[model samples]
Target: MNRKTLVLPAVIGLLAPVLAACGGTDGGSDGGGAIAVGTTDRFIATADAPAPLDPAYAYDVGSWNILRQTVQTLMIQPRGEGEPVPEAAESCTFTDTGNERYVCKLREGLKFADGNPVTAKDVKYSIDRALAIKADSGVSALLSTIDTVEAQGEREVVFHLKTADATFPYKLSTPVAGIVNPADYDKGKLRDGFEVSGSGPYKLEAKVENDEMVSAVFTKNADYKGALTVNNDKAEIRSFKDADAMDAALQNGDIDVMSRTLTPEQIKKLSIDPGENVELIDMPGLEIRYLAFNTDAPGVKDKAVRQAMAQVVNRSELVSKVYGSQAEPLYSLVPATITGHSNSFFNEYGDPSTDKAESLLAKADVTTPVKLTLHYTTDHYGAATKQEFEVLQKQLNASGLFDVTIKGTPWDSFVPAQRKGSYEVWGMGWFPDFPDADNYLAPFLDDDNFLKSPYANSVIRNTLIPASRREPDRGSAATSLTEIQDIVAEDVPVLPLWQGKQYVAARDDITGTAYVLNSSSTLQLWELGRGVSG
Candidate 1:
């Protein structure tokens, strides 16, 4: 859930002008010939290339992107929008009035890339294995409501939940629920390496590893029988050190497509550079960047201290100065694009108030020049992150009420360190598992969540969430979402910073930029192709 995923930009008001000004074009081949797509050459060992392409263990965006291409889930968010449709399953539905039981009927003649039959047993094994391994970064928490998964005959899979959960189907759409061949993977532990056995549009042909980097080659899976259409026979994905390098590769024809991590300035440059022959696809802004406070850390243990910290920070300034127009101020844990989202923080604290912050600190008996350490990942959250934190440091220290020390570590070390409570306050970014407000709430606030900080709220976790899940009508859960937002604003365990716009730059010859992005902001590799005309 904390992974930094890629996205395709949509033709929207914010980006329409940019696209028009740039003489925006589509990606397609000239007539009929093969096309080669390239990704970043720089990959992080932990975040990008941690091995075993097992859906149960793949957590980061890089891993998920590969899994999305190769694995077949019972349901999927096709083109990344709406409720998930049947992928491996011919049909899926909730059977009982309480909504506790769910069932799926497998599609006929389904087979893996290896030409092995895909049965209901494989579906049961996949879910069971994910729960059993329980990797720290895995999506087991999303399935916590499931009590049992059983296969009925060869084509049917049934799930019995401990409680009613209307959002259960959405979980099935994520890569965590991807079906794997039981014969090729272990049921009790993570699969050993990068080798993957799946039933999707593409199959992994080979992988090349470099220093701190990995590149994968995927060919069309002849046995693929899913909703996705394979436009190209093959694709090559590589990791890059940063967006600039990725952009350079794309401009130089070293790569055919570029997604994720492009700075606002880079995007602006691309927008006006007609000679680049790159099409910029704009997508909705659903990604959120936030600051998480370790409640156990000194100088932040007091609730008043946390609230004061929130009051002093200016989200608008962060967006304008650091993020430019690529992001917007986010005042709640849930972004405005999602249903049930509320600007609770804005209502509670209003604009940046030095007087109010000082008053709150006085009430907590906090002395001026309160010393604190702020931590962030140097490489993970993009190049702007360092500048963003520096801006925050200056803003917090400007009041003469705080002594802030900025600390940064690479993502590999940063994730574990933050989870272990090694940082007092830190920055984190989230790409949704699904396009729902519940995703924003559950992952950060659930019991023993990814935050790994000593913080808990019974009403939000034990009460509001379960109540919301039981509500058959998702819109009716607005009351619970509003209450949860209000509670989070009051507690200020995590400060909502900003939400980002998605951008994907593809060569003019690439045809499917429009279809590459789904609602979840995940790029569909199969949708990309070179037009024969190019």
Candidate 2:
């Protein structure tokens, strides 16, 4: 499925650069100086890319979380643990009239950035376009039940679902259902990347093609009726290639914040770096890094073959050598941050014992010289991905059980190839939507999952997922997901290698850095500003 890549307005040429310096402010106090925020602006924030700026198209939590505050959803997910609750809509009622008909009443005063009051019509148009385009992964399947969305009135949108989906409201909380400005889109496309606008708190200050893109915060819109989180007056995003450069900029007083994973090696250096105010905030990350098998491909289709490969992965060695203990060994695809996460695979295979792996492979009749190509992304994640794969290849080959060939691709090509079942085995990572166990299980277990792993166990797929989804309460759903985890543990289609620990080194002058563990990918732009006392 080659979806059309949306060509957003080219990122505008670099605007006059602002001076980067630091100052202190108390809660709700304006910085009076620039607050520089940094990230690796690897991908242009656009709809055509794997991750886009629009809530409707952005899949990964990295960009979507930023979009969440900027663009309001029909329902807002609570920033902390637990099930998603309503935000933009006062209440949504589902009528068991078969086709999963859901009627929602919007909270008063909701409006887009353009000052047009948000109405039922806008929601319908946003959802309809998603179903029509279906190329952007973020919005397509999430709106699974929406057969038709018709405006019942100005404040109410009625959704006629295609099936009896009881968990429809949960889907509404996701950013994919974000309402868009009708005037900005052209036949399911965005022409003005620079002018790209949303109903969110901040607006794009200017767009640059692949260069630095910036945005500024405004007082809550008079038409806007949702909750606002940040206390900062404005935010400036400067994209960098790696954490070192980001740290360097922070040291030079070129940026106010550096919020992303810096390797453990970098952490050690930043701690001692002169003039670098390094802060270590350890919150549960919403992301999971794993080795996915192309189940459709030969050699990987066998469970023992997959398990043998899984057992050979020396996670400790990978972490020690490549990540330097910054990451924890993983057992299942589920990250420890989520409620129902379990070390299911670790409970079974904790050590990288080649003898045990060989026995299992022998029992399954897998002979020596088992060979396959391992693919990894060169530009994504961090510098350690390739080293991680290199270490993996050495461990497996040293065992004399398998021979390995490694291939590399950039994140853009790597994503499509992995999704389209193009690789035999590949390295991949995930950042969950709302810190739920179902996000780890349901998205990966589906026979047609994005990773293209068709590991469909009826127990986990049909029953466990659907059951978890129906529970309005996440606690109950987590129990169901635990059962799903056990099933996944039994059939290891994907090997959980390690859980990443995010490392951010900020200048000592920056303060009010609070980690809300709910959305691991969010920077919580409001809670941060210049140091109140330093």
Candidate 3:
């Protein structure tokens, strides 16, 4: 879910598909290809979303991958497992206990890549423009709580929120809140093309071929005054279309690291034998995949129909058959790693019992062999997506209660079609915009959700979500969050499939590979370096 509408950000999360971009430096000794990353993510830019690199419109992980290095937000989610730390701002805190009015003091002499002074006005302008240009979707919804922003002199900016929200700081850590230069970007519309200008650890120059971003060289921004360390002088992020070529590039020493989407075959082989000079790095994952149905669709519109399908499908079988134990079966939209996670779906539909599925349909007066078309993207989620859908079709059809067919659409078309509720049922993968459980549930369940499905429960959206956001200690909101999961499990608008563990294949000489992908799914390129171990 991305630009033009709000669907992309919630569906796709903030990232496009893979690892971020940087410039070329060199080998283990420091000479070209220093941090060349090979990823299978193909960035699709439509007329509605022309600027994939602009912070005002870059919501997908692919664009966020570049934005994290090229731009700095008010706060930064540190490389590993710490809370978001200040980057552009020296220090920021809520001025009042209500969590509505917040204040941030800019660090002394912070400047954009162009060497222009970054003042309170720029911060105000960046936030204000993002709000004003809400004509299209970015991750602007994340910043929706911001009622107004006022710049007090050069070093200070004040934020007034619509309601109390403790998750505001975490939202600031995302690419949506990234600080931008006033001179380089348009205030009313999204900046066109892949070029980016921001004040972060790096200055990026991207290469685009036929509307797709191919390479972006990230040279260290000497004028950047942020908390992150710049390990490499230059870094290059190369996007590949083929997983085989990506693996070949990593093995052949043409690329230092490979991430985003790795094939199951590659993961299995790499785990067994990582070959000479290669290391397989697996991190705690914040990514999840699920099946969402359009609530108004003919075949699955009835809640009973949706519930029956959810009961028949077996998440354990799919994860094992596809990921080969690289993923865990998810019982809720919120992954287990997140706070307030629960096995609400499992508690309701424990086993893959055809009897349970048949009974549910019979009680609802839905005829036998309910026809359903499961839609998935061909190019976006990698090779396993097709097989995953095929397995899903087989599982449902074999149950004798449903007739399911799978359709694979290209990403560019799939996204547009999803916005129009073209698919009765479709598969989507979400990477959290922040670590909070609200991020996982709100985007799909809210009344103003990104999903075309009209799935809305006032208690969960207006009541439960606001309640969770009000609590300063996120852990204390467990009861409310757990209740949301239970409601979602009962409604069955979206079916939880499986949660994934992130994998990054890096050369032995690449330092900071472990810290590249943080819990928030933002790739921290500043952590990557050659010829050093961390």
Candidate 4:
């Protein structure tokens, strides 16, 4: 969710006539070299929705990605493909003592965007504060095993874990671990974010809801050291509410970048050439969408009833019709591209049919029609979700086993309503905090998991996650993740539907845009510059 915003003058010397002809009399297009990026809708980071100024509260991946551009992780993940290597912190390793303590030494001369030195205490404060505020912060759950974070020296920070948590490094790599200015954070209070502060390459200039965000280069910051691929002297984030509007702005030269909303067709149409003009990249996304059956809700607690509803879902048709073949058909709760995904669910329930659904319903003694409600977010995700639910309704009705009702709330209310267990069945999607299978299983499989869907399997809850956390080996972790996936499929708390894709469309003038990292979806800002000779 990190955005690279730039505010600078652009030289429109020769394009003045062109701008005039296109009705560009406003001062938005100026002299120098600046680029404007566009997205659909507004961004609200309020006390109620409180987007934390610190990374510890960074539960929103989008928000963290934006913060990543403004700050630095102890280890920066590379933009291109490969296992993560060290970035800001020179090297990191666990202590030999059986206490399972891990330590990271900061790279010397790393300063905040405001010129304050980054120290070991800053790191300790960043993590501990998140844990301290976990009652209100969604991010505290991610650091569950962290027993204590103590500053060892001016340049070093040590983490004492409750147990052998191998994923601690990966958790630290998340934006939530982005180092903050200790001066801004209080022991247990949210900080004011209007004045921008961080050690990243860009400095915040303006952030108006649904309007635009602007940033300028932090020229004196030594931490940048040209590590970033995008160093677009300046960056701008302009919001829009619809794909068509976003498309029009890009085409009219009002926006230089796009995220999320543009469809495959829109991207194809915008690209002057498939690999050239418009940068088109389909990265392996960490997001998985499915129908969550609130097992605690009446009637759905029955395994047969859950299986019956899951059977009635025509995932193939849902992908083809709702997603226009842009998304892949998902069978396991985990998507196939992810390391641990398996086809166990597909193997068990191959296709949608009344016979299979009715058989399961009959086993549950549901001879009479079952009435169910499916909930979704109206403005979130994409337009296809509504149509996807409609198709679900039609498919379930076609089975003659259930009568269904579909409801939707705006994205804001959607989360709260679902958490209150207000829906019998609802469609939800998860974008991993980190690109790992454990993130997918641990959050959803545990009985006392977040979202409280009452979907839990003792094998997954108590056995699989603990084993994977303590395995201490990459190969073992992958195998353990796969086993957890199998157990999740068996429990049938959530039925996999389809995996989502990140689609971006750009005008022919934008270059170096194709290589942006898909995991964070944040442009390096420095890498984006004017195209080959205008």
Top TM-score hit: 3
Better of 1 and 2 by TM-score: 1
* lDDT for position 160 in model 1: 98
lDDT of 1 by residue, 1-534 (tens): 111222443434334323321211443332433344444323444543354467876666666778888899998875535666788888999999999999999999899988999999999999999988877763688888889999999999999999989898889988889999888888887775677898988888555554343677778889988766677777777667778778778878787778767777777776666244666766776789999998888879888888988899999998899878789999999999788899999999999988899999998899888899899888766788899999999999997788998998887778778767788899988888887788899888887576775789988988999888888787899999899999999999899999987777777767877656566667677777777323
Which parts of model 4 have CA positions greater than 4 angstroms off? Answer: 1-32, 45-47, 52-54, 97-99, 135-137, 192-196, 209-230, 271-279, 520-523
Q: Estimate each model's TM-score.
A: 0.92, 0.84, 0.92, 0.85
Q: Which lDDT tens digits does candidate 2 get at residues 31-126?
A: 556566776535454323523565555676455645655666776545434445666777778766552778888888877877878888878888
Ordered from best to worst TM-score, the candidate numbers read 3, 1, 4, 2
Model 3 segments more than 4 A misplaced: 1-33, 135-138, 532-534
lDDT of each: 0.79, 0.65, 0.81, 0.64
Cα miss at 38, model 3 (Å)?
Answer: 0.9
Angstrom error at residue 24, model 4? 32
Which runs in model 2 stand beyond 4 Å of their true positions?
1-26, 45-51, 91-103, 136-139, 145-150, 159-170, 186-195, 210-223, 271-278, 509-511, 515-518, 531-533
RMSD values, in order shown: 5.3, 9.0, 6.6, 8.5
Give the least accurate 10-residue stretch of model 1, judged by summed lDDT.
Answer: 15-24
Error of 1 at 307 (Å): 0.7
Residues 408-507 of candidate 3: C-alpha lDDT, one tens digit per residue: 9887788778877788899999888888898998878764466656777889978999999999888999999999999999999999999987888887
